[model samples]
Target chain A: MSTWSPSASRDALMARQQMYRSIREFFYTRSVLEVETPLLSQAPVADPNITPMQAGQRWLHTSPEYAMKRLLCAGYGDIYQICKVFREGEAGKRHNPEFSMLEWYRVGWTHQQLMEEVAQLLQMLLAERFSTLPTLHLSYAQALQSYAQLDVHHCGDQVIARHGQALANADLDLDRDGWLDVIMSHQVEPALPHNTLIFIDQFPASQAALAKLANNEQGVLIAQRFEVFFNGMELANGYQELTDAQQQLQRFKHELQGTQRSHDALLIAALEHGLPDCAGVALGLDRVLLHLLDAQSIAQVLSFEWQRA
Target chain B: MANYSSNEFKPGLRVMVDNEPCIMIDIEFVKPGKGQAFSRVKLRSIRTQRVWERTFKSGESLESADIVERDMEYLYSDAEFWYFMATDGSFEQLGASSEAVGETIKWLKEQVVYEVTLYNDAVVSVTPPNFVELEVVETDPGLKGDTAQGGSKPATLSTGAVVRVPLFIVEGEKLKIDTRSGEYVSRA
Candidate 1:
C-alpha cells in the first residue's frame, strides 16, 4: 500500500476550501449572481476549434458560455460559475481531457472593463492568501514587438516568415499564427514577471475570435480582448462581447471553415433564439492552482489524470 | 504501393520519408486558430543518428518502410565486433565497439536470444526485454534504523552493472530490474 502523510493531506484540504471560499466571497461582494447550468446539452458549440466529448449520442458542454449568455438575454445581469468542462485531445502539463473552469460574464461591460475586473479579483485573492500581489499589463502589439521585434498589427506575412527563419532552432515549422505563438511562448512569455500577473491586451482584429473591435487612442483598430498570464502560463481569456448577431454568425462561420471546421446545430439554434449583448471570460482553474501552488504539472493538482482514470 | 496516412502512425511504425528510413519519435497534433491543420512529428534517421522535425497536412499520405524483426542468438564478442547466429542457421555479425554495446554487453549471455530490428535488410537496433533478473555481487551490509524513507545504496550486479538498490536489499539476492528505466522492481 502507498503511504500518505496526514500533514500533506491537511494542507491540500485547506487550500481547496480557501479557493472555494475566495471565489464565492468575491462574487458576493460584487453583487454577481451564482448559477448552475446543464452539463449536457442537445446542441454542441458549433465552433470547429473545440471538440466536445460525446456521451450516449449527446455532447458534453464544452463551456457554460452559451447558456450563460442566454440568461443574460433573459436579464440575469452579472453572473459567474465554477464548473467542469470537457475537451478531447487536450492532455498535457497544462491541459486535461476534463478540467475545472471559472467562467464569469458581465452585462453591458466592455472587454476592457472585464479585463480590469479580472486583474483586480486575482490581485485581491492572491493578496488574501499570500499577503502580496504581482500584476503587469501590456498590449498584444507591444508584447510582440518587445520579444519578437515584429509588430503583428502593422507587419505583413513576410515579416512573420523572417521571424520564423530566425527561430529555426526552436524546431517549429513556420505558419502565420504558429510562428507568432512560438515566439510568444518561448521568447516573450518567459521574460515576463514571475512574481506578478501579466496582462496582454489589444490583440489584432484577426486573432480576436468572438471579441468586439474599437479604435484605441492611436486610432488603430484593435480587438476588445485580453489574456492573463502568470509565470509563462496562460490562466484566463476574456473579451468585450460582440452584440451584432449578424457579425457573430459570420465569425462563427469563419472559424468553422478554418481548422475547427465543425458545424454546431445548437449554436445556430441559439443564434436564432437571439443571443444578448454581454461580455464573458473563461479561466483555466487548474492552471491557476498550478501557479498558486508552484507545481509543475496539472496532474499534480488533479486527483487522477487520464492515465490513472 | 499503398500510401500510409497520419491516422495509421504510431511508435515503432516505420515510414519512408524522402525515400529514407525514418522512425517517428514524438508526434503531436498542432493547428492554428485559423488556417489548415497539420501533424507535427519528430523523426530520427535510422542510418545516421540525426534528429529532425517535419509537419504534414492532416489526412496527407506517405509510403511505409519495409521493416521487420528477427530472433538471433548471441555467440561471442571480439575486439571489433559482436557476432550472432540467426534461427535459420545463418551466422550474421555487426560491428559493435565496446562503447556501442555499453552496459548492455554486461547483461549479454551466450545462447540467449534477442529481438533485433532491421530496416531495408540492415540491422538498425536491438531491444532488450522489459525485465531482467540478476544477482547482486557486492553491496554494503544493511543497517538497523535505515528504514527511513528515501534511502538508497549502490549494489553491483553479477553482470558488472552497478545500480541503486534499497537499503534493505542485500548482496547475493536476485532482483528484477526494469531495463528501460534501469530501476529496481522487486526481489526475484
Candidate 2:
C-alpha cells in the first residue's frame, strides 16, 4: 500500500474547511437560511441527460434539487445547501464520482434576477478569497452567432448537422442540441473572457430541461437560465423554475421518452404537492476552488478522488 | 487482419501507416461537447525515427505495426554507419547520419548493450543506454576555494563526450549522465 503523509493531506483539509466556511458566511450575510436534507432518497428525479448513481436499489442524490424544491413548497423562503452529490462515469480532471455541490433558491424572482444575484455573489465571494474579481456577461444567442456563425435560436437540425460536418472532415452524426453543445464548449466557451467569471444567458427553450421560458423581444422563446464559467471551466448552472405542474409533468415525460427511462414517481408526487415559483442553482465547489487557487484539476481540491479511493 | 480502434489505443501500441511501423507516442482525448469525439495522437515511425500527428474518430480502426525491439551490443561506428552485433553473433549496421543520431553519438561506447528497433526486418533507429557512467579523461585542475562557487567546469570523458563537472570534481573521477536529456546526474 502507498502511504500518505499528514503534511500534504492536512493542507488540503484546511483549504476545504476554509472554502466551506466562506460559502456559509456568504449565504448567512445575505440572509439565506442554511438547510440540510437527506443524501439518500427513496425516489430521485430522473433526467435523460443526467444519470443517477444507484446505492443499494436507492438512488444517491445527483443534486439536492428535487428535495430542495419540496422545501420551497413547504414554505421555506430563501435557502441554500452545500452537500454531496454522486454521478457515475464522471471521473476526470474536472469531475469525480462523488462531489460537493452548493445549491441555492430564491422566491418571487425571475431568471434575470437570479443571474444578477449569482454574478454579485460570485464577485463578493471571489474578492474576499483572492482580493480581485474577474467578471463578463454574454447571451447564449450572441455566443452562438459569434463563434458558430449560426444563430442557435433560429437554426434547424439540418444547418447544425452541416456545421458539425464542416468542423472536422471525419463523420460526425450529431443532433441540433449536440452540435450546439459542441460549438459552445469548443468555440464559444473557450473564447470568452477568461481572466474573470463569465455569465452565459438566454438559452433556447429546447435546452431548458427544468427552467421556465419567456418570449424575447424578437418573439423567440428563451429559457430563463444562466451558466457561470471561469477560464473555460463550467462552474454553475441556475434556472427560473417552472411552477406549472402540468408543464413540468409534460417535460418529465418528454425526457423519459427521449432517453427511454421510467418516470420518477416520487418527484411527480413532490410536484403534486405544489412547488412555489422560485429560482435555484447548483455550483461545482471543486471547480470553483480549482479556479480560485489556480490549480489545474478538480482532484487537487478534492480530499480523495475515485482513482485514489 | 485484426483492426485496432483508436479507443483501444494506449501507450506502447504499435500501428502500421503506409507499410511503416509506427508506435504511438501520446494519445489525447479531445471531443467537441456535442460532436463526434476524436483521439488525437502523436506517433513515431520506427524505421525513419520521424514523428507525426493524426486524429481518429472514436470507433475508427488502424492496422498494427510489424516492428520488433531487440537487445544488441554496440560494436563500432565508421564514417558512414554504426555497427552492432546481435546475441546470435550476427552483425547489423544502421546509417548514422549526423542529424539522425543528433547529440546521442557523444555517449556511444564500444560493447555497451543497447536497444535496436527494427521495422520489416530492417534497422530503423538505435536507442543508447538511458544512463551511462563515464570516466573523466581531462579537465583543468580544481582551484583553491573554488568549491564554494558551486559552479561547473567542462571536462572531457574517455568516450570523447564533453560534460559539465562540479568544481570539486577532478580528473579520473567517474560521473553519471542521463543519455536522454544529456544532463549531469551524479557520481557513479
Best by DockQ: 2
The lDDT values for all models are 0.71, 0.74
- In candidate 2, what are the lDDT values of residues B32-84, reduced to their tens digit? 32133556567887766788766555567889876778777777777687776
Error of 1 at A7 (Å): 18
Across A1-309, the per-residue lDDT of candidate 2 in tens digits comes to: 233522125566676788789888888998999999888877655665456777886778888888888888888899999999986545555667688999999998876788788877677556645566666777888877876788777768888767755554334465677666656655676777666777787888877878889987889899887888878877888898877778888987887775545666666677788887888888888877776667766667776666666
- Quantify how close model 1 is to the true structure by its C-alpha RMSD in Å: 8.9
* lDDT measured at residue B88 in model 1 versus the true structure, 0 to 100: 66
Candidate 1 residue pairs in backbone clash: A48-A260, A49-A260, A111-A240, A134-A196, A134-A197
Residues A1-309 of candidate 1 have per-residue lDDT tens digits of 233422123455466568878989999999999999888887666655467788886779888877777677667789999999987656655667788888999887777678778887777656644567656789988888887777787788777866764543433455676567555654676777787778888877766767889887788898888888877777788888776667777877776664533555445556566656667888887766666676667767676665566
* Position B133, candidate 1: lDDT: 84
Interface RMSDs of all predictions?
Answer: 5.4, 4.9
TM-score (chain B only), all candidates: 0.68, 0.78
Candidate 2 residue pairs in clash (backbone atoms < 3 Å): A182-B34
